[model samples]
Target: MLAYRMRHRIQFQRRVQTQDPNTGEIIVSWETVLFSGRLDVPAEVLTGPGRELIAADAQQAETTARINCRWFPVDRLELYTWRILWDGRIFNITSAETDRTARQEWRLRCSDGLTDGQ
Candidate 1:
């Protein structure tokens, strides 16, 4: 793994839901920092076929990033409840997978069009 290539710093945030003190209303917040480290975010390029597939589904485009496990040790549970913050942008993680042969890195499929407002 090219550790030097992980130049883009990113923050992993987990959504937490809690009840209000007096109002007794459930509030959503993202104050937990699960991990903070450098990542490699390459520009996404969709081919003709790939574009067609997305168009058919009416799905918004997404950006994928690769993170080194040495820098950020993320587990499966965290993957489902965490989102990434990079360069003032919020990215919702669609999937997180590690290589079967070498679990030193994690590929995160993310989307910028969606937010954790719900």
Candidate 2:
């Protein structure tokens, strides 16, 4: 990974659990965690919402980003367990690829999309 390009700090989490403070009840389901460290986002693809920001439609927008970070061992099945955390938004890790030749970094495709009424 390029040290200079590692300007953004990102964290990879597999699982997250949230609970209601008052009731002590589980508010969110449990999830696994990846790792955390500085990262380089050389490419960020933002597809427009395609229409005007009216009301509920804005929640259906989609955003994708290409992230590059230091190499880490991850199994194929574990891809479903990884999520990227940055800028207060959680980006799901859709896919992951490693640099076989150099073994230097991992190319990650992430997306932060929402469904209607969400």
Residue 16 displacement (Å), model 2: 6.2
- Evaluated against the true structure, the overall lDDT of model 2 is 0.60
Each model's TM-score, in the order given? 0.65, 0.61
Model 2 RMSD in Å is 5.6
Question: Cα deviation of 85 in candidate 1 (Å)?
Answer: 0.2
lDDT of 2 by residue, 14-107 (tens): 5555888899987644343434433423332332234333446544556767777777666756865667667676777777787776377877
Model 2: residue 50 alpha-carbon error in angstroms: 8.7
Candidate 1 residues 73-92, lDDT tens each? 65776776777667776767
TM-score of 1: 0.65
Q: Please list the C-alpha lDDT of all candidates, in the order they appear.
A: 0.57, 0.60
Instruction: Give the Å error, residue 36, model 1.
Output: 8.8
